[model samples]
Structures are given as C-alpha cells and as structure tokens.
Target: MKRLLVYLWTAPTTLVGLWLAPLALLTGGGVQRIDGVIEIHGGIVRRLLRRCTLLKGGASAMTLGHVVLGQDRTVLELTRAHERVHVRQAERWGPLFIPAYLLASLVALLRGKNAYFDNPFEREAYKRAP
Candidate 1:
C-alpha cells in the first residue's frame, strides 16, 4: 500500500520534471517568488499534487516558512496563505511544533475524526489557504 501510494504520488512528478526543468531554480513557474509568496513547480513539488486529491496541474508546492502542498489552482488552493499559517504555528511553538502537530493529528485519528480537517494544524492551513 505504501508503495502504491508512493507510485501514485510520484508519477506526476516525472512530467513536471520535463516541463519545469528550465525554471527549476528561477522561482516563478518552477519556483516563483512574489511579494510575499513562493511557488514551486518541480520534481519534489509534483508529489504534492499527485498525492492530494484536491490539487491540480501536476501538483505545485509553496513554502512560506515551511512547506505547503498546493494540489490545485483555486483560491482555496493550498497556497502561501495556508503555508503562512503553519509558519506562524512554527514560530509561536518553536521547534516542538511539528511533533505537537503530529501528535494532535494522531489523537484526532484515534477519535475517528478526519484528521486532515480536525487536526489543528490542518485546520489552520485550510482556513488560511486563500
């Protein structure tokens, strides 16, 4: 199952590599940098779109302070705003932030709620996705 998931997630990246090679380090298309935003389109980034059912265009990623998975191109797409929320979380909590986020997600899973939506980090991410 893990392998299957990885395959499903990685297949799109192959195409992305061909398409985004020229702009790999250029930042804008392959790795865009706006006033306060950063868009990534490359091999590593393609996985974000492949894995997430909500994304589009072969998957693109962004990192405000951390990494964001922008699977699609809607305003609600997992864009910089969403990533920025995580940036805030990391800043406020310091280094223990990721572990705490993971723990909270595990708790939510144990409780049977959809962790992606119920997890506080994800909630913040989604709420700020626009």
Candidate 2:
C-alpha cells in the first residue's frame, strides 16, 4: 500500500525524529498524528529557532521524514501544506535528505544565490504550498 511504502521510505529519518520527540516534549511541545503525518509543536524549539538567523522571518515549520516540527500551533497550521511537501521529499531521499539539502544550499550560496530560495527542495515545496 502507499502508506506502507511511505512509512518504509521515510523510516530512517522518522526514527531520528522519534528520538527527538522527548526533546520536543521537554520544551512544552507535544506530538500528534495528523493526516498520517507526525506533527511536533511548542517547547524550547521556538527559543532555539531564533538563533538560526538564516530562518528569520522565513521558516515556521520544518519536516524531517514524517515528522513536522513547528514553532507553535498557528505556525504549524500556516505551514502545513509546505511542510507536507518536505515530508514527501524526505521519503524520496531517505537519510540522504539532510546532506543533500545542505549541499544544495551551499552550492546555491557559492553561486551567489539565495540559498533557501534557490535550493531545489525549497523550490519544489514552494511550488506545492498553498
């Protein structure tokens, strides 16, 4: 089934996400299953998020495998569609997703482009986001 395929495809990254679940909880965030996706919200992630200047005013939620981590409930709702596309990308790339994404961004930056906006993954997600 498609669901099984997706689960298997993203299993590696999902495992990583599961490991971070406790940290999410510790930050006053909780996890939920929504439309077959694992959503993690709240906690110290928001405070820590501010440290990532690259994400300033841009990223509200990020998807790692089937898990989506958000700054808050409102941000989660707003970015759900965008993050879902990233879930699919993670399924497609498996454990290679992170490194590949970073490489893409680095290449973009070296070429004097906006790393996030020029990265193929973000472009794909943006195209599919509402």
Candidate 3:
C-alpha cells in the first residue's frame, strides 16, 4: 500500500531516530506509538534537546522521519501539531529530508535570516501551528 511505501522510503531516517531509543529507555525515558509515529521523551532525550541543538536552549521537540523526540511528554503534547507538519515533510522528502532541511537552514543563514526561524520548512510548520 502507499502507506507502507512511505514507511519504507523513510526507514533510514527512522532508524537513525530509533538508534536513540535505547539510550532514552536505559536512562528512564518513555516511548509511544501514535498515528503510526514513534514518540520518545525524557532521560537523555531531554539533555540532548537542551544541549545538542543549534538553538541556545536547543529544541523542545524534533521530528525525524516517522519518529519524534521531545524533552518530555507534556512538550510533545504541546508541539504535536507543529511536529506533525514536519512528519508530513519527512514523508514528502524521504531520506533526503535531513539534507534538505540542513540546506534550507544554510540558505537562510547565507541570506542573513534566522536559520531556524526563517527556513521554509519551519515557516510552513509555524504557519500551520503558530
């Protein structure tokens, strides 16, 4: 079916996200499956979100293929709509999503724009969710 194909197409990125799941679990995080997406939060996930991102405080939530990582369950709940927009983006771009997203950020910065805020993908997500 079409859905299966989309999952297959995005599998590589999904695998990358899933690679973090064990770290989350071993460190006391939780995982859930919602609307065919895997959601993860807490433990090292929170720290990673706080320190590993380009943002000063890092991101509260991030989407990778069919997986979403959040600082916590509450933040995940709050950002679901916005992150869903990214899920659709990942579905559209498949394995190229990350590269395309990074490229968008670089382009935004080169244009003297706020890379995260001005990236077209973020703009679209904000338009739908903000």
Which numbered prediction scores highest in lDDT against the true structure?
3
Worst 10-residue lDDT window for candidate 2 reads 47-56
For model 3, give the RMSD to the true fold. 0.6
| Residue lDDT tens for model 1, 1-130 | 8645533343333233234434444433344444433444544345545674322443344332333334333422435566667655654554456557668878988999865568888787777664
Question: Which of candidates 1 and 3 reaches a greater lDDT?
Answer: 3
Clashes of 3: 0
User: What are the clash counts of all predictions, listed in order?
Assistant: 9, 1, 0
Candidate 3: global Cα-lDDT? 0.94
List where candidate 2 sits over 4 angstroms from the true fold.
Answer: none
Top-TM-score structure, candidate number: 3
RMSD of each: 11.3, 1.9, 0.6
TM-score of each: 0.52, 0.87, 0.98
lDDT of 2 by residue, 68-93 (tens): 87888888889998999999899899
Evaluated at residue 23, the lDDT of candidate 3 is 91
How high is the lDDT of residue 81 in model 1? 62
Cα lDDT, model 3, residue 42: 97
